[model samples]
Target: GLGDHPTVLYLGKLSRLEGSELLKGIIEEVLESVPNAMFLIVGDGPARESVERFVEQQGLSERVVFTGWVPHSRVADYIIAADICLLPRRHTSFSPYTSPENILKAGEYMALGKPVVAPKMGGFADAEFPVIPAEPEEMAQAVVEFLRNPRQVPEFQRPTWEVSHARLQRVYSAIGAVSR
Candidate 1:
């Protein structure tokens, strides 16, 4: 069962854009701090096979579990199973305007009161989401801190994922990105 280990979950695309390639270093660092840490990596993309090969090479087969891909309806189960959630992707230059609001899984994780460690780029920059926005290299420390002292995340209301009509008018009038 997952009860015996500190489970860290990464639920999203496994592409380089998503920082999936950096998972190897993050995993190795996390294990150094918390030897019994278990990683539950979900989703699949171009980098999945390469990431899997690294895991096997390091003989972390028992410590890490990859679920390939699961249906959207089942994401909550994985989020609930984790001790901590991670937004492994650090840079989002390709999509500079990507909004964190589009990350449906983030709302799910925070709604379940999971402490998410996301990078301060893309949509996550300056956003008021209830997550820990730490650099990707510093992620291991953030994960270890939470595992050592679990805390209830502040109440997070799931956003309606809608653009308010009033807000749109404000942006049009200002001719700039809106902030509120």
Candidate 2:
């Protein structure tokens, strides 16, 4: 993906449909451009074996670490260890439903003041984070740019549990008013 960067992370389920296939190309392109770069492929799925094989085939085993899956509480540790947070998901038919506000990782990565490189689809074009096409070339360019000139996160707004609960209460009240 053209986003989210150094000590780069391609976080999500390790499935081809999730854009794991894109990583092989992106990784090759990125390594050629930024030889010192390392990648972290976090999460587990059916495609894990093949993805690892491809990385090894490219002789990138030393540079890419596959954590399989980590506990949710530990996710932040990985994000903190990285220079950027790249989501490996391609824009899908359901993409219109995805946005930094709804995607927990986008918020997590941003909360840590890291650039989030996500696809240009969905509502991300106007997003405060780096929005670009996930094609390998485009993504690599955005990623390299961030690594060369790390973008600073200005503000990340994710409703806390208390805030979400209050919103739900308001929603329920509205429903009850309509019934009455």
TM-score top scorer? 1
lDDT assessment of candidate 2: 0.70
What is candidate 1's lDDT per residue for 1-180, written digit by digit as tens? 178898999887787877776788888778778888899998898989988898898888889999988998898899989988888765555655444643666767877767788776666666653677777788778788877777766542433334345556677769756544
Candidate with maximal lDDT: 1
Candidate 2 residue-wise lDDT at 26:
76
Q: After superposition, how far is residue 77 of candidate 1 from its true place, in Å?
A: 0.7
Worst 10 residues of 2 by lDDT: 128-137
Compose the digit string of candidate 2's lDDT tens values, residues 1-180.
223335888777877666677777877777778877888888899888988998899898888889978998888888777887676566666554564533677767766656767766565556755443354347777777777777655542344566567677888888895342
Question: How much does each candidate deviate from the true structure in C-alpha RMSD?
Answer: 5.6, 6.1
TM-score of each: 0.78, 0.74
The total of clashing pairs for model 1 equals 0
